[model samples]
Target chain A: MAPVTMIEAIREALDEEMQRDPAVVLIGEDIGVYGGAFKATEGLLAKYGWERVIDTPISETAIIGAAVGMSYQGLRPVAEMQFMDFIACCFNQMVNFVAKSHYRWGGPVPMVVRGPCGGGVHGGPFHSQNPEMWFVHTPGLKVVCPSTAYDAKGLLKSAIRDNNPVLCLEHKFLYRRVKEELPAEDYTVPIGKLAVRRTGRDLTIATYGAMTLHTLEAAEELAMEGIEAEVLDLRTLAPLDREGILESVRRTHKLLVVHEDVKTGGVAGEIAATVNEQAFEELDGPVLRVTSLDAPVPFSPPLEEHFLPQVADVTRAARELARY
Target chain B: MELPEMKYPLSREQLLDLYYFMRLTRELDEQLVRLFRQNKVVGGLYSSIGQEATSVGTAYTLEKRDWMAPMIRNVGGLLVKGFRPRDILMQYMARSGSPTGGKDGTSHFGDLQERHVVSPISMLGDLIPVMTGVAMGGRYLGQKLVTMTWIGDGGTSTGAFHEGMNLAAAQRAPFVCVVENNQWAYSTPVARQVPLHDLAERARAYGIASYVVDGNDVVAVYQTTKEAVERARRGEGPALVESKTMRMKGHAQHDAAVYVPPEMFEYWKARDPIARYETWLTERKVWDKKTKAEIERRIERELKEELEFAENSPLPEPEVAERGVYCEGCHTIEARWERPIEQLQPPKASVQAAWTVSDFGGTNGGGAAAKAHAPEAAEETKPAAVAAKAAAVSTRGANGGTKRSARAAARPKRRR
Candidate 1:
């Protein structure tokens, strides 16, 4: 298999799923003819036809609602948000309807609401957001953010096949920047599992999405300075993979959570709390977080660099945690 | 009251069935209210006292294979769709044997496989898009089924309603939306909710056909919905049937509806749907006094047994609440494909690659201009239950009414 970008991997996952399962369909704004705003669905409309590759109105509520409905009729619908920030438009449908359908009525809402998220391209507040925590806070919804092309393809395939609603948050920054060769045979990276990106001993830096790249970069920098920081990619957020976090923390004796989302109500807080509650005795130092400031994403390059946790931020945080 | 000349081609038996369902709906609500007053109901009770006709008539037009999602007040529709009184009672009481296994209360339960009923969400207009999806999904799965859902005047104001309706119209999805313009949405009146007097006009913006009918008139509701369902089944796209009626009770049992003027209640009381239908049946000689009495007796007896069964059903175990959050090998959902499954395969599923650039000439692709690529036409199969129902009505003789009544008197209703 040849090397593929994260966007290409996502497109292949959708294409293969549609080919394998007759019930799979895609719905989103400008997804059919205009090929998606990000071109994640560039040629799907031509390949699958308009019936399967639906170009829905600019109605997030309808896109998600219709996908939930399609799931009821046994069709696996992969809906796109154009940008994840617009998912707020259909929050009621996602939280009140899709998330609670199974608990409320023993019904299965098997669908995926995937879109590009995270800040780095200066998309400002609306277009750039790490909104995985919104659905992560919701029960009955599985949240995943793939940091690499392999996980992006494999995880997306798993999300489509899962019998419950899953939110696949793809970071726009890593869409083209991250590329890797995938296996020729079909495979799926299981949901609710974390991936170990780098092996070390001094400290553990847990991150996901595009932040994984920054964390890994920081680990490389720290390794040169004799501070070996293990990198744990928290791939699945909702089912927080506590064992994996605890296992790495137990070995390293220190933990640092890094994320691009804002500090307050961010997933970093949840990770820190999980470590404190479950692995309190295993930790030698307080679980530190290298998260963006508690403010909306700024559009300016310098402001965004300051707002988002850079590789320097992770390195500084990991160095301090390793000393403790 | 003088019943108008029979407008629709409804046989006497079918007319009698409508009356029975309306009465059953009203009677069931009365029992639910009593259960509420007795503190047996786990949640608030929503009474569909004055709006029985709309639910019954529209649901009666649907075949068994079709799907529908009912609002809190559309219990009549649930009954017509074959949900027993015990099911509603157990659901309200949060019994272990309820539809949702005591997971939900009130009319928030739906049966996907057998009855094809989708549950209603607490957020009002959400079902519109969901039902539209169900309609489109069914078409893709090669099932010729029409999907229906209800919305109140206030719910029509939600963004979901507009978005869902537009999606359905754009896809030419086989969907029928029945707007129960029940004058008031919760404490808010329709006047305060929307600028248009008729909510059906909202559908016109989407280029879908719309109708305005007397919701209190059962015959009119049935005929209008039948027309809409038939049109949708014929691949003519979605249609909206705005049935105007009044919410005879408060939004739920908790509110006293103090905001409702006394005159409004008096006005709607005189036009009660069940009372009007009873009078119509008597006037049209469809149901004589004896037949009506027999029907009422049958309803009371059935209600008593169902209520007793509901009362005896136990509450779910505390442990039961911990399970079934995510479908982990517990429930499997598979669509019942009516047409050949191979149609969805490769060469048959291939579509033309040409883009019709002329459709979006003047706009930025936001307009509902190009409704190109309507669902591929499949061989139509008439719903078996609908055909059987029609056959049953046509074959009944003069003594058919008495015969049905006698059979009801002899047979023991099975308990769910």
Candidate 2:
């Protein structure tokens, strides 16, 4: 087994999907001869030809709109937003049309819109943004942000084959950094499912996407101090795994939600609210959260590191929760 | 087409069929307007009215298999392409049997399997790229089919329109981009928007040839569209045709029409498309008052039956509300695999190539296009169980309808 990057896992998933179904087509800009801006679709065009591997114009709106149109026509289209930040251009179509296609027309837009998202490498505000909250607020859309290669490959395959519009946020940070040997055969992971990264009985931690790996490292250090911590990877943010969270909370009796997104209105808030709603009876301490400060992710690395919570922060937060 | 060495010219009956579909548009409009006035239809919309030239004009040139992406006002085009009259009327009345299942209002009337009409979207010119994709799809399937999109003056301002046009040009997809500049976008005149003197000139920006014509004259519209369609079918790529016409009614229901200049109406009114076409045919002795009366009677009788059928048609069951949210059984069974946490491993490739943006067979600037709104925030967020309570924002926002944002507004009518 080889250690593969997150991007490779995504490519493997797409390759498997294209091989499995003729109707699975890829549409995005620079996805043809040039592969992709990041080259995630390097060999797809040659294998699939012009119809299945389509390179659209620079218009995100048109890409999204056409994908919606094609999906309505029964083609399982995987539309890639060249960059997640560019999604703003198609915001209306995604939020208004893609997300609501089922809720509105009873029509399925079984499609995957994957792109480079999040910040760390100085892509700046325009190029890097964590817009998961926007889709989180939207009811019809299902959002997937994979923190590990295994989850990335599995979740992407599921989204591409899904009959609903799925937003897959692939962190630019994890594209090359995260690696794992995906299963040799084709596979899929169910949406709305959670993965428990590391388990303990004192304090529970919930997070997703790139933050999952960070918090797991945090949990390892917390264990050094005899402070047991439970880490839950909330793979699907929109359909938050409440059962998983509540169960973990009931086990640990102390809950802490964490995310790389800003603190206000972040997914942690929703989980916190729900824990208070459904499992408050089991609470032994007020739920704590390790989230990005309420500010734009800065350009400087030092500031960004500080802006984004680190292993020490999560371990410290858990230590306090353990004491409480 | 001359084909460099033609034989006989197009026959009288061929011209008559062109007249035939155009006449159907006029009759449908007249009947629908009267129905709205009688309170039979749910909403009042702008009739193709003075723009029949473009609607029937372009469609008459299409093969049944050739695709069409019509604008909202192209009911004539959709109907001519074989969309059922009852289906459309049912749609207008927001009835259950409508292809959109009684949800989307009449902006784009389309069917993927039938007549190859793409479902409609209403952000004006946004479907240009999509229509281009349809053409590209036709080409990729090696069907040699052309996909045409009908646009208006307002739609010309959209980025999707430009993108679609450019892509079509680059890929040489068989297409016809019809511009129906009826001199009005609700209240603004074409003069107030475009200063190019001719929209056909904009085509030059992309190296695509274009033609201009009087959209009020069905003969001119049909003739020009036929030429463009033929060119596309010949693999010569796309053409943009600007049809100059007028709007005969207010934009839609409750329009004060204060913006319409008195002289402008008088001028276009005297040149009423239906009347003008009828007169043109009659002077040529092709049809007379008696025959016209017979045609009108037939349309009237059929419209009556269609309306009756739609009005009495049963609505979709409230219980089946969740149906069609996705394709029925379009699910791929997940090849589930599970391993204990101990077996988990990191991925192999440190980084991989990014996915290329595939150039779908060819078919921006921006002033942002817009939304499907929920009636109220709370109703949109938390839908009311009572259909009446949530009816205002009830549409699930399919076919690009006005979206109801209140989560509660869109729920299926609950069982007692």
Docking class of 2: incorrect
For candidate 2, write residues B140-206 as lDDT tens digits.
4446677788888878987777777877765566788888878888888888898975676677666
Recovered share of real interface contacts in candidate 2 = 0.18
Show model 1 residue runs off by greater than 4 Å: B1-8, B357-371, B376-416
Which one is best on DockQ?
Answer: 1
In candidate 1, the residue pairs with backbone N, CA or C atoms under 3 Å apart (3 or more residues apart, or in different chains) clash, namely none
Which window of 10 residues has the lowest lDDT sum in candidate 2 chain B?
A: B369-378
Clashes of each: 0, 56
TM-score top scorer: 1
